[model samples]
Target: MSAIIRTENLTYTYSPDTPFEKTAVNDVCLEVEDGELVGIIGHTGSGKSTLIQHLNGLIRPTSGRVIIDGQDIWEKGVNLRDIRFKVGIVFQYPEYQIFEETVFKDIAYGPKNMGLDEKQVGERVRETAALIGLDSALLEKSPFELSGGQKRRVAIAGVMAMRPKVLILDEPTAGLDPGGREQVLEEIREYHRRSGSTVLLVSHSMEDVARFATKILVMNHGSVFCYDTPPNVFMRADEIAEMGLSVPQITRVFSLLRKKGIDIRGDVYTVDFALKTINEYIASKGSAREDGHD
Candidate 1:
């Protein structure tokens, strides 16, 4: 399958030629396949935010290229507005981006910008709102009047209304209670399931990524550290820790178990996988003992 998004030697520098000049992203090359749920994790200042902004043309690279559908997004005459429509991004605290008075208008912002008519825009708004569990009645109320979680839903619905082919979310679950976080993450998961769109989820939580992401991308010091399946990435737990990141909690538990001479896989990143591995190990041990007794 072809890549939906590809970045080649992409680098971005801030305040170039000045004392404040700094490279936020450096020679980062990566590919995200169509219909993938990719999780991006990194330490602070690792360029996760800067890298993602390039995907949607929110920021241009000082060097290198961001290619979408095999076309260079920054090529002369490329319609950047159209590119933004195809690649929707919800930044950290996306709620701050909300400016429309009513929830309906806020959610309709993207569709309207796409030049859809009232009927199409309203339909898209309602559909996306429903997808994010927003009530139709709440659509008429001001977004500021909603609860924190509701505000997040409205913000997410705003992006989903545009129905982008590639949806990028940055820290979608930050500053929320466990219930709120789970709700938002689950809605994102369901959105991916139903839309079949490529998703880039930039999060700090290894457990969340381990549970949802099809693949994990680790960034360190403005470069691509590792891009692989969760299990493969977690297998480098020591390296990840050295870089100031970590694998999931259960993965650490299993790793500890292995150190204690238990015959268990240390690479399990989720509780469910850990349980399955442990149960299988116990069953094998039980069978061996039974055979010896026989």
Candidate 2:
């Protein structure tokens, strides 16, 4: 399938043509395929956010082009508002954006703007709220009256109501408890599965990304550091550490085990994989012990 999003030599400058000018993204090129779940990761000030903004026409590239579904999003006469509908972005702490008196109104805002029929907007609002785990009864209540986690879910439902083809989330679970975080992440995964949309998750947690993303993009100092599957990316533990990043905890544990002379693979990123490998090792050692006695 063709790329849902593609960047060619994408660059962005902050305070351009001024004394305080700085390049936030430099000579970057990448492609995000249709229905792919991708994660963008970086330390602070690595331009991850800036890069994502270009994808949905939120920020026009200072140089080069951003193509969404074979069309240059910045092209003349192209309606950016339409692009936004196609590429939904949920900002960090999206809950803060909620201003409507009721959760239903907040979630319906996007579809309403699209001129959808009232019935369609209501249907979308209810469906999206359910997808994000928002209670049906809460739809009529003021959004500000809800808990922080609940507000976050409402905000996410707001975007999902639009049914965008590409969904981009910037730290969807920031500042939530473990349970809240898991809930939000699970909702996002379920949305992707049901909609078959392209997903771009920007997060700092390697473990979370490893669990959800099919591909990982590591950014450092306004450039692409690496892009690969989680296992392949985490395999370079030393390099990742040098870049002020880290592999998942399970991967790190396996790496430490390898250093201690364990005869097992060190590249395991998921807990399930790590546990399976450990069990196999134990079974093999047990067989060896029996054979030695025989």
Q: Best candidate, lDDT-wise?
A: 1
Residue 164 lDDT in candidate 1: 97
lDDT of each: 0.92, 0.91
For residue 104, give model 2's deviation from the true position in Å: 0.6
State every prediction's TM-score relative to the real structure.
0.96, 0.95
The list of candidate 1 runs beyond 4 A from truth reads: 288-294
| Candidate 2 structure quality by residue, lDDT tens digits, 1-294 | 999999999999999889999899999999889999998999989999999989889898899999999999888999999999999999999998999999999999999999999999999999888888888999999999999999999998999999999999999989999999998899999999999999999998888888989999999999998888877888787688788886788888888888899888766888899999999999999999999999
Give residue 233's lDDT in candidate 2 (0 to 100). Answer: 84
Which parts of model 2 have CA positions greater than 4 angstroms off?
Answer: 283-294
TM-score of candidate 2 on Cα atoms, chains taken together: 0.95
C-alpha lDDT (0 to 100) for residue 109 of candidate 1: 91
**Model 1 lDDT per residue over 1-294, tens place:** 999999999999999999999999999989999999999999889999999999999998999999998889999999999999999999999999989999999999999999999999989999998899998999999999999989989998899899999999999999999999999999999999999999999999888888999999999999999999988998887788788887788888877787799887657888888889989999999999999999
RMSD of 1: 1.4
